[model samples]
Target: MALNSKDTAETLILLLNRSGQGDRAAFAALYQATSAKLFGLALRILHRRDLAEEAIQDVYVKIWHHAPSYRADKAAVMTWMTTITRNRCLDLLRSLPPEHGLNEEQSFDEWASDDLGPLEKATSNSEARALLQCMKQLAPLQRQAIALSYFQGMAHEQLARQLVQPIGTVKTWIRRGLQVLRSCMGAL
Candidate 1:
């Protein structure tokens, strides 16, 4: 049977719960369902195929261990997993050596994009599409600020310096942009 959003979330919850009990099959199923989206998110932030691969692997190991702690009321499965992936990528990026390609001068170009290519590949869910739609409506700078802060994991001070704007301005852009997103999302 085809699964709606509710059904899909329920299945994921079941899989997570089972995996917490050390069910390898359910864990495998969960990984199969989520790894692409999670990997895409990692790749977007890390900007290296190898690092993204490493991050995905590490995130799943944590997921396998923390599956029991997942509280459905706190977040949906995808949101929870995405949080873990984002955090892991940030951690990996932070610990990278100067020999690695990462540096303070790295461009904010990736975060500034509204391309739905990654999202399209990740999921065709209505909510995902709606978010993309809302994101499209944001001013480019607002999008850039939000993306850099969220995905690239830059602090307000860092973003201000990187963008050559005042710190308050950077914070304002992010706050206002998030407001717009929340309003737009609620409307949808």
Candidate 2:
């Protein structure tokens, strides 16, 4: 029988709770169930298979370490995991040389295929589209600053260095961009 999104989410929560208690079997099951989707997310962000794989490993390690602290109220289990994976990939990206990191772009269409199940994909696609639309509404520099800070997980100093702007200017751009995004998303 197939599980719906609620069922799947419930199962993941159970597994996460068990994993929090150091249940190896539950952790393994969670890994088996979610790794592909998480890997796809990492690959989308980093645009490299090897780096994505490394990010997945690092993400899982952090997940294992941090499981006991999981709060269902804070975010859904999958959302939390995806956040960790994305951040790991961004960290990897930051560590790379600028020439290799900023210049690479691979087709994400192939990376997403069959990785996220149907319902998950549908939900993700809608959310991604909404975010893209809101991003497009920003001024070019504000959009760029926000993307680098949030999507790429760059610090203000890093963004300043990369964009050749002052740190305060980078911070202002990110702050104003986020405020605009919040207003835009709130209207949706």
Candidate 3:
């Protein structure tokens, strides 16, 4: 039950090394040390505890199965594990429908209910927040296009069809919308 502090660095390294070499006990220790934090991260993005927990379980399962594929020099164990968790979350998002799927425009407000507690505020950079605010300023159509393209896995043609617009119009809106968002975001 050691926290992942500097004091546990050596122990973590030992566990990672052993886990890489097929040691189940060391792998279990690694999961115990990091699952909570990883699940918290997933919950932040996915906004569902059950989904987050399932994602966390899937992530660790993959980690155990793929320990030997990890490269220590390429990333710290936590970073690698986080990447795995993020990919799993994205995959799950992709598999879902828009409301169920990754709709960037889907406000967290909809997900908030009496049962859900306040979301922990992530320490985002001021610049990033400003940029997000600027994106929020776009016309609803333009914003929808961008959100659909970036978050909903929709291609330009797909978005155009969905929006009942011409392909060129969708492309133009995305380009113009991005430029405006960038300039506005940068100024903030």
Give the candidate number with the greatest lDDT. 1
- Every candidate's lDDT: 0.82, 0.75, 0.69
Candidate 1 wrong stretches, greater than 4 Å? 1-4, 98-123
lDDT of 3 by residue, 41-157 (tens): 787557778888888899988887777777667766766787889878767766666666434454333222222122223423344345556755666677667755643357898
TM value for model 2: 0.68
Residue-level error in angstroms, candidate 2, position 100: 3.5
Task: Provide TM-scores for the models.
Answer: 0.83, 0.68, 0.54
Clashing residue pairs in candidate 3 (N, C-alpha, C atoms within 3 angstroms): 97-101
Better of 1 and 3 by TM-score: 1
For model 2, which pairs clash? none
Positional deviation of residue 98's Cα in model 1 after best superposition, in angstroms: 4.9
Weakest 10 consecutive residues of candidate 1 by summed lDDT: 101-110
